[model samples]
Target: MTQVRFMNWYLKIAIGSAIIGGGMEFFMINTSFYDKVTVLEAEKGAYENSPQSQAMREALNPWRNKDTEATKTP
Candidate 1:
């Protein structure tokens, strides 16, 4: 009877530890995901505001405004 009681206690402790460990792992993974997303967002903003982006936009402006220029010419 005492051995059975000890086994029950050990099982409870093991289950409780598993639950706590899973919760901690879930929190860490979510935190890491958000941190990576934030870094990617900042990098995207930097790339969009860079000189190369401006030059590309300028280079493509003629094609983007092609219809407007055609209408004005006639």
Candidate 2:
């Protein structure tokens, strides 16, 4: 009788944990967290593809030749 009682308790805990975990995981992944990440990635890609981003990159390049700088004429 004691063995059966322990087995029942174990089975109940296991099944309850599985159900609760499945629900929690479903909510977590379906939240705005994923939406925000996707939006952030899209904005990042758009900025990277913009001409302004390329100009900023060139202006910030350390290895660029001094002759190419806009402050001075050839």
Candidate 3:
């Protein structure tokens, strides 16, 4: 009966430690992912506001200026 009690205690400790370790790992991974996403968002915002992005937009939409021309009195 004593051996059985000891075994039960050992199993409980093992399971508890495993759960704690998994929780720590999950927290670390989520923190890392959040940091990465933040950095990427900042970089994306910077790129979108740059001249290169504006030039690309103009190049992609060549007819963007035609509306003003069409409304002009000739």
Candidate 4:
């Protein structure tokens, strides 16, 4: 009888742990925050690819030490 009670307790614990683990995994898989993150990243990429972005990049190229005088002789 004591063995039966022990087996029942073990079964309950196993089932409970399984439920908790599955719930956390399901929540992670169904979350929507990743969608919003991806959308924002795509928008930023698009803006960086625009003509104004190209011009700004070109203007900043000089400051990036593109001039021959800025090159290290080493």
Best by lDDT: 3
Shift of residue 46 alpha carbon in model 3, Å: 0.2
Tens-digit lDDT string for candidate 1 (1-74):
99999999999999999999999989979779778888999999999999999889979884877888899997
- Top-down lDDT ranking: 3, 1, 2, 4
lDDT of 2 by residue, 1-74 (tens): 99999999999999999999999878878886778889999999999999999889888985576656765875
Model 2, 25: alpha-carbon shift in Å?
4.7
lDDT scores in order: 0.92, 0.89, 0.94, 0.86
- The digit string of per-residue lDDT tens for model 3 on 1-74 reads 99999999999999999999999989978779778888999999999999999999999999998998999957
What are the models' TM-scores? 0.44, 0.46, 0.50, 0.42
Regarding TM-score, does 1 or 2 come out ahead? 2
Worst 10 residues of 4 by lDDT: 65-74
Candidate 2's error at 66, in angstroms? Answer: 11
By descending TM-score, how would the candidates be arranged? 3, 2, 1, 4
